[model samples]
Target: MALNVALLRASFEVVATANPRFVHRFYEVLFERYPQTRPMFPASGMARQEEMLTGALIAVLDHLEDAPWLTETLGALGAKHVGYGVTREMYDWVGASLLATLAEVAGSAWTPELNAAWTEAYGAIVSLMLARAAT
Candidate 1:
């Protein structure tokens, strides 16, 4: 499943300006929907965490065309996540929460086509992450 890079980038640009709030809403939705996952994050330094999340997303999106770098970087991230106790099943929860948050924040800019593209993109990301973790 190929991603609609243009749409993703454009929509992200719209959301990026409110990154702190966006990240806050993302975690709020994630924890509200799946309370069990809350312990995975620290109680403090959320600002830093938000920065990391947005930074990572931007890096991945920017390097989407660079397969080698993307794979290597995501692989390393996946391995690190494994150490942090992130399981394969959790990826689905994260993806759903992420999409929901994006839709809510994107407002009218959100469309079925954009949803499909993000779904595909997230799936691909999780697939790579899981594959790397398996080793």
Candidate 2:
């Protein structure tokens, strides 16, 4: 099934509304799960980290209804990430991080429907971004 654009946006809006600590928790879980990403981000950052994550989240979610843009955007993101030294494994790790963060702050809103929606949304991104990174 196609992913739900509204739910995806709502989920992001929900997370963004949370205390800034949610951002900290997201990054902590993400980095702990994939220490490899530590090099992708600065060593000492909280605001910068939140800004990047929140912005990226908004960008990805906003384009959920546009497949061509999603592919192109993700591919570009993949190419840019090459400079950050991300790997195919790291792309997969990023997906894991995304899901983990959602689950962490999702509360009752993180239902099966939300889970499927984000998984598909993130998977579409990972597929293209990782493929571009591979080449």
Count of steric clashes across candidates, in order? 0, 0
> Per-residue lDDT tens digits of candidate 1, residues 23-78?
78998999999999999899888888888998899998897787888788888899
The Cα RMSD of model 2 versus the native structure comes to 2.2
Best by lDDT: 1
Clashing pairs in 2: none
Misplaced by over 4 Å in model 1 are 18-20
Residue 78 of model 2, lDDT score = 85
Total clashes for model 2 = 0
Best by TM-score: 1
State model 1's lDDT. 0.85
TM-score of each: 0.93, 0.83
